[model samples]
Target: MILEVAILDVKPDLTEDFESTFKAASKIIASISGYISHDLHRCLETKNRYILLVRWQKLEDHTIGFRQSPEYQEWRSLLHHFYDSFPTVEHYESIILP
Candidate 1:
């Protein structure tokens, strides 16, 4: 499994708007192939910062399957510009844990 993570810093004033947009957009992404699960959360210490975590069966499921789909285009259009800066997205695999 792979975890796709994005750390976003949205404009302070746009936090509520951004969260609403994200809630709608999540349904679109949730239905894609290899998409196992997902969650969106805000930093309690800093409301402007958000962390998005998506679990997938494979990396291609997110990169190729979702991004190339037409639905993704619409999803992007609905929720892309709320960010104050470019969202920093990265992939991860579980490592040593207690």
Candidate 2:
């Protein structure tokens, strides 16, 4: 499985709006192929900062399947404006331990 992470820095005074939009946008992402689950977390120290964690079956499930789909436009429209700067997203794979 792949874990996608993004640190979102929302514009000043827009955290409430951003969170609400994210709630609506969640449905869009949840319907995509290979999507397992996701969480959006707010920072206590930095009120406008948030962390988005998404679990997917594979990397391409997000990079291609979601990003390239029309649904992405909806997601973008709903949430992109709230960003202070574009968030950098990265994916990871779990490491097994003995």
- For this target, which candidate reaches the highest TM-score against the unseen true structure? 2
lDDT per residue (tens digit) for residues 6-65 in model 1: 998999999999998888898899889899999888999998999999999999998999
Model 2 segments beyond 4 Å from truth? none
Give the range where candidate 2 is weakest over 10 consecutive residues by summed lDDT.
Answer: 89-98
Cα lDDT of model 2 by residue, 1-98, tens digit: 99999999999799988888899999999999999999999999999999999999999999999999999999999999999999989999999945
User: What are the runs in model 1 whose C-alpha is more than 4 Å off?
Assistant: 96-98
Candidate lDDT (C-alpha), each = 0.91, 0.95
Return the TM-score for each candidate structure. Answer: 0.91, 0.96
How many clashing pairs per prediction, in order? 0, 0
In candidate 1 the C-alpha lDDT for residue 68 amounts to 98
